[model samples]
Target chain A: MLELKNVSAGYGESSVLKGVSTTFEKGKLTSIIGKNGCGKSTLLKSILGILPLSSGKVVVDGNNLHSMSRNEIAKKVAYLAQGKSTPDMTVEQMVLHGRFPHLSYPRRYQEADREIARKAMGVVGIYHLADKPLFTLSGGTRQNAYIAMALAQDTDYILLDEPTTYLDIAHQRELMNLLVKLANRGKGIITVMHDLPLAFNFSNTVAVIQNGTVVAHAEPSEICGSSVLDEVFGVKIERLPNDKFYYDY
Target chain B: MRCYMKSLPKNKIANIYGIAILLLILSAVLGVLLGASGISLTDMLSSLVKGDIESPEVKILLYVRLPRILSGLICGAALAVSGAVVQGVLANKLASPSIIGVNAGAGLAVILCSAFGMIGGWSLSAFAFIGAFLTVMLVSIAAKKWGASRGTVILMGVALNALLGAISDTVITFNPDVSVMSNDFKIGDFSSVTYAELIPAAVIVLITFLVLITLSNELDVLTLGDENAKGLGMNTSLMRVVFLLMSALLAGAAVSVCGLLSFVGLLVPHAVRRMAVTESKHLIPLCALFGAGFVAVCDTLARVVFAPYELPVGIIMAFLGAPFFIFILIRGKGGHRNA
Candidate 1:
């Protein structure tokens, strides 16, 4: 499990996160949903050791994140953001960059490394574009390419910040299905999502944040109830007698 | 078009690198042979193999064009390799050492020293090195405080370039006699160089090339973007400073030898990347070979194109290279970063 304790972080003194604490469990799909600037991304970054916490501690798999090296944390968790503006890298080459933690300095790729990268591309269904330059790929294709890279890292935990922001409906479902499959295989998948319907239907657990703190962490059924929706999002929900779902808009 | 778009089978990029270098060596040899003296290939070979410097033609060839050829190769390689590093580090296609004012800074300092008559007996190179170091220092500070965005770095570079240009021009204007010497020097001549001046400059370029090549992997990570590289455990700021210093050293050394030659650094890497992918592993060696071959070819053409009155290789390169560069840009494929 990845756990954050009183973590505070920001970019150069504008402290976006204020003493937030959360734990992401293994073998589960945990979705974080919040309004704009609610510190969802900041929480993920702090847990992954990308953003240095000002005072508190983060522990991942029993290893203290602050005490360990960046490479060590990289091996434990693979973090993917919404969109990467990388240029000129082939899909295969970008995936191969994930094997960095396994390779030492003067890094070289063995046949096995290529095999893992190929497998990653296969998993993400971008195998055909392995030789295509990343810039030429469409937005959805490029996002999958980065996801394939994170998959190639083969870490225990995968943290994604709005991974489905650019995808069409079909691709959004496809990626959400892929995340469910990854979680089913006993890997922890933590994603910060803005699409409420998709997050409610897909995730095993949802953590709702408001103003830099997680307001509710519970199963989808519990969090999707009318009262929880009204409390978290400040919206009143109506349920029709014939319909099985609650609607809050 | 379908066949063309089929995934390129991975030929070992290193193999291509080796082939390009071999071709460069061959071109450099051919370049050294063809000159105004017109020594026969047979006589040149026999003298070189037999160590018979007794022949005046052989001695002249060995003493004169050999150092000049080596200088061209080294300078070309230095400029191209540094260009690749700077482009990657700044994440800007146009961020060459010259464009960023490192060359002007060194060139100005060298001219200033020569104009003042303070370097009456000293080597021009030490002054060039100091200028180069200062330029890198100034640019680094600017890149930090101002941020190394594509717009900011280039604007700062242009501003610094204008300042250096004005200072150099003012020094020349104030001292006309020294201006004549500086003008002759500024035409980018390699003909009259002594072994003393050539050896140290060559060494500096080689050392800088080695340093840059060693950091090619870091450069690969760097080009992805600063945040990505930092998350991958690289100290991004430190790497940028080191890269700028190396580029300055290389450009400064080249200027000390051949004055300010433009377009080789800018053109060579872009050309290499256009033909190949943008991976630094392939990019660096291909650049070295192509840079050496390019300058060698341009220098040869400069010598023979208007025989008895050699054109400056710089003028020839810009005249020849600029249009091709514009064509690449206009074709809407300035390689991946620009697109």
Candidate 2:
């Protein structure tokens, strides 16, 4: 479990996350939904230690995150950031980089590391693209390649930030389904989502942020019963047939 | 060790290395034999292989031609690899030692050293490395602070290059005694290179090259950009500093010996990338070999084209490099962050 306790962080002159706090449980998919620039991404960055906490603490499995080295944090958590560059690296090479935290100094990939990356590539179904550069692949395929790299990291928690922003509808559904599958496989999946219907339907838990503070943290079913959704987004969640959902403005 | 990357398989890299080695040999031979009074290959070979140094022609081969050729090999490799690393770490295709004012910084330091009568190879190279390192850190920090665009970074480099050049000129104006160095230094000629200058720079380049090769894979991770690299557990800022330091050392050493041989850093890496060799393990070593030979070839051309009135090797580079750079830019493959 990863826990953020009264954490506050910000850019140089302006505070973005003001006393934000949350808990991420293992073996579940949690979605953070918010309006644009509501500090959803900033929340994730603070958890990853990419942003320094002005006050308060981030605790992961009883270990204080501030005291842990980046290597230690990485061994327990993986990240999939948005707007990834299309570098001149093959899928296998990209995936293999997930083993970075596992290696020692003068780090070189071992045969065992290769075996793990291969398994990760297989998990994301990019095994056959081992030699293909990411730039040549389609957007969906490239996203899968990055996910494969995260999987190769083999951490208990995987955090994604606006991963579906550029994908088509079908690809978005496919990615959400993949996240569900990973969650079922006992990995903690935390993602910042934009699609309200998808976030409410696919996620086991939804945390709604309004102006850098989470206003509602509840189970998906509980979200509809509260007035927070309408109060924040001015929308109502309507359940559809076959475990589907719709947002009515 | 036996892994395979696409198109550039291990065997293919081996073949490329083979060609690079052969080219280096051929260019070294040409450099040795292309001076004002040309020595035949046979006589050159006998003078070299037999270790005969009594004759003036053999003395020329031993003293002047040999040191110059050595400078071409070592310093060229340093500059080219420096360019490759700069491009990688910055995630900009257009970033090179010369373009980003690294060479200019070193050139300024060299002028200062000469003006101060600090003419020893060790002190000169140390000053050069310090100057190069500080300038790179300045550009890098300014870019980070302002969130500089690719074009803005290049503009900064141009501004720094002009400013440093003016400083060098002013220093030379006051210290007329150092005017000789400033004159040959601007165009980057290797004719006056000596063992005192050559040895220290060569040592620094060699050591830095080995260290870079060891860290090549980390560099590839860095090119993936900061957020992802940090996610992968790399200390991004620390690694960036380390890599930039190595790059500065390389450009500084090259400038220490060869006096700002322009465009080899920019040109060699661009050519290497065009060949689809992006992995740093292969890219770094290949750039070294290819760069060494490429500079030797250009230097030979400089010597042979005018015979007695030799042009600086930098002129040949400009003629070749400017066109190629323009072509790549126009083609929308400016080696941008698009990979």
Candidate 3:
């Protein structure tokens, strides 16, 4: 399990994640949902060590995260950031980059490296585009390409920050399904998503972040109700005939 | 079948192949005949095959023309490869040793050495290497402390170049052997190199070139941006240090051997990228060959164009490279942000 205790972080002067504490269990698809500027991305960044924590302890599987080297942390946790773009590399080359932490000095790719890359690309459904230059690929394809690179790392914990942002409807569903599969296979998958329906239906648990704090953490069934949605999203909820809550603009 | 083949990388591959062959042939042929005491093309060829020094011109051709040509060839390749690495790492086309303070750093080191009366052909080269290394180290430090954003680092490089240039100018103004030293180092004449003295510089360039080619793939990965590279498990910091060191070695070697020849460092890589879209594997080699060939051709023209009264290779390159640089600047007007 990945756990953060009293995590407080900010850009330069203004603090964004203020004393937020949360626990994400293993083998569960945990979705963090919130309104804009609620420190959702900041939470993920702190988890990935991209953003410095002002004062907090993050532990993964009984080891203090702050104590581990970036390479060591990278071996255990695979992070996917929002607005990530593919480099001018082929999909296979992109996937193989994930193997960097596994190799020692003067690293060389063995047969197993190629197999792992191939398998990861296959999982992301980008195996056929392995030879295509990443710049030439569509937005959805490129996103999948990056996800595949993360998967090739074979880390136990997968943290994604808005993975479905630029993807189409189908691609978004496909990516969410891939996360579900990964979680089912015992990987700790945590994603910050804007799609409330997908978060409610696909994720095992939903963590509502509001005002720099994770105010409510529960099973999706319990948290997706009208009262909880209004409290987190800061909008009055109306129950529609479709049994889904509707909110005014 | 033909349509499918056309859509493949055939055009780029063919262009590269044709250019490589043509450059190789031109370099070999031009290296023989372009000298102060010009040997006729036929005698230059005949001397090589027969090992017969029948004509007075043939002896000069054998010794002077061969060594000078080799110097241009090696230095060009070295500068071009250096530029390619820097550009790749920074992901910016404008980044080059000349623009960034690598060349200036080497020049300043040699200048300081000359001031202390440690000036000689070989020792001067060593000073240049030290200078280049120091400049790169300074830039790396500045980059790290002040956010290694591509634009910020490039600006720091320009500032360093100006600072070093001022120091060099001040030293040259006060020095006793100012005229001769300034003239030799400023314009980059190949006439100074002999066959034997050029070997060390040549070997250094060759070894660095080989090392650079090995890292081209890693460089390609780098151009994808840092986060992506890190996600792949590559030690991004270590890779940057290695690349910066290698590029510094290359720039230092070229400046030490040939003085400051601009444009070849900046233009060759840009031209290569424009003509082809491949990973660094193909681009780096192409840059090396093209850089070497471009300089050789320019030097040959400098020797033969205003024949006997010969221009410096650096001057000829300025003439060739300046126009192209201007064209790029104008065409690049308000289009595509500098990377």
DockQ top scorer = 2
The list of candidate 2 runs beyond 4 A from truth reads B1-8, B44-51, B180-183, B323-339
Model 1, A189-212: lDDT tens digits are: 999998877887788888888777
DockQ, all candidates in order: 0.32, 0.55, 0.29
Please give the RMSD to the true structure for each candidate, in Å.
4.1, 2.8, 4.9
Give all candidates' CA lDDT scores.
0.77, 0.87, 0.77
What is the TM-score (0 to 1) of candidate 3?
0.82
Model 3 local distance difference test score? 0.77
- Candidate 1: segments with Cα more than 4 A from true spot: A226-232, A236-248, B1-8, B11-19, B46-55, B112-130, B133-149, B173-181, B184-187, B331-339
For candidate 2 chain A, the 10 contiguous residues with the lowest summed lDDT are A240-249
Tens digit of lDDT per residue, candidate 2, span B21-88?
99999999888877887777778777767777786678888798889889988888999999999988
Model 3 chain A: ten consecutive residues of lowest lDDT: A237-246
User: For model 1, how does the per-residue alpha-carbon lDDT over B1-339 read when each residue is reduced to its tens digit?
Assistant: 112123346676766677777868876887777887788888888887888887866787778788778888888887888788778877778778788887888888778777766342236767777787788678767786766667788889889988998888888777876642455366565666567667777888888777676676777777666555655556677888888778777777777777877788888888887775577877887888888888877887778788778888887788889898888766755444562
Candidate 3 lDDT over A120-214, as tens digits, reads: 87777878787787767888888888878888888988888898887788988888898898899888999999987767667888898888998
